[model samples]
Target: MTARERQRWAVLGVAAITASIVATRSLVVTDRDRVDRFVDAVSGEVTPGRIDAAMRYLDPDRQPVEITAYEATEAYGPGEREALRQRVRERLRAAAGMRFRVLRKSVTMGARSASVSMQLYSSEGAPSAEYVLRKHGDDWLVETARLR
Candidate 1:
C-alpha cells in the first residue's frame, strides 16, 4: 500500500480503539455512580431517622433480613430481619457516634434492577463496613451487611 494510505489506516485503527476505551470507561463510571447514589440514600435514611425514606428502596413485600457478624457467611431471612435492623441502628448510635457513610461502592446493573457492594465508614473513624444492596425499581435497599 502507499505510505499515505497505510498512515490513514493506522490513524483510523487508533481512533477506533480510543473510542472503544472511552465507551467502556464511561460505562464503568456510570455504574459506579449508580452504586454511590444508592448508598447515599441508605446513609440518609439511617442518619436522619428517615426509616420510611429508606424503605422506599426496599421491596415492601420482600421484608428485611439480618445477617450478624457471626452469621455473616450465611444468607439472611425474614425471621431475623427486624432484629438485625434494630441492632444496626443501635450499633451505629453507640459505636460510630454518628450514622454510616459510603466510602466506596461497586455495582452491577440488570435489565431493570441493580446490585451494589459498598464499603462504609463509621463516624468514629474505625475500619470500613461492607454492605450489599439490591435495587427495587428505581431505589436501592440494603440486603445484607458485614460490620467490622
Candidate 2:
C-alpha cells in the first residue's frame, strides 16, 4: 500500500476502536445507577390506574416482604403480583402530591444480587428502606423492599 493509504487505514482502525470503547462504556450499567433508576421509578408520578414505570423495576414474582407503616410483614408470592400492584397503586394515589427525596443511600453489590439502603424524605414522613435486587438476564429487578 502507498504510505498515505497505510496511514488512512491506521486512522480508521483507531476510530473504530475508539467508537467501540465508547459504546461499551455507555452500555455498562453500574449498580449505583440501577439503584438510582429504581428510586426514580418508585418515586415517579403514578396515574390513577397506571403504575407501569414503577412496576417495570419490580420483580413480578416477589413483593415487599415488610412495610413498617403498612404493618405488612408477610411476603407476597408469585401469585400475588397483581395484588401487590394494586396495593402500590392505592398507595401512589394516596401519596399523590408528596415529593419523595433520597436523603442518603448505600449500595452493596453481589455477583447476582444487590442491596440498596436509603433514607427517604417525603412531605408525609422520613423513612429508611432497604431494597433487594436480583439480576435477571441483563436487567436488575427489585426482589423485595423493606420500608420503615
The TM-score leader among the candidates is: 2
Q: TM per model? A: 0.46, 0.74
Candidate with the greatest lDDT versus the true structure? 2
Q: Using alpha carbons, what is the TM-score of model 1?
A: 0.46
Task: Count backbone overlaps in model 2.
Answer: 0
Predicted candidate 2 versus true structure: per-residue lDDT over 71-112, tens digit per residue: 566456677777777776776677775666778888888988
List ranges where model 2 is wrong by over 4 Å: 1-5, 28-36, 44-50, 60-70
lDDT (Cα, tens digit) per residue for candidate 1, span 1-148: 9999999999999999999999898767454466665566666325534544444444424635444463445444556555545655565554332566666766666654456666666655544445566655444556665655
Residue 3 lDDT (model 1): 100
Error of 1 at 106 (Å): 2.4
lDDT of each: 0.57, 0.72
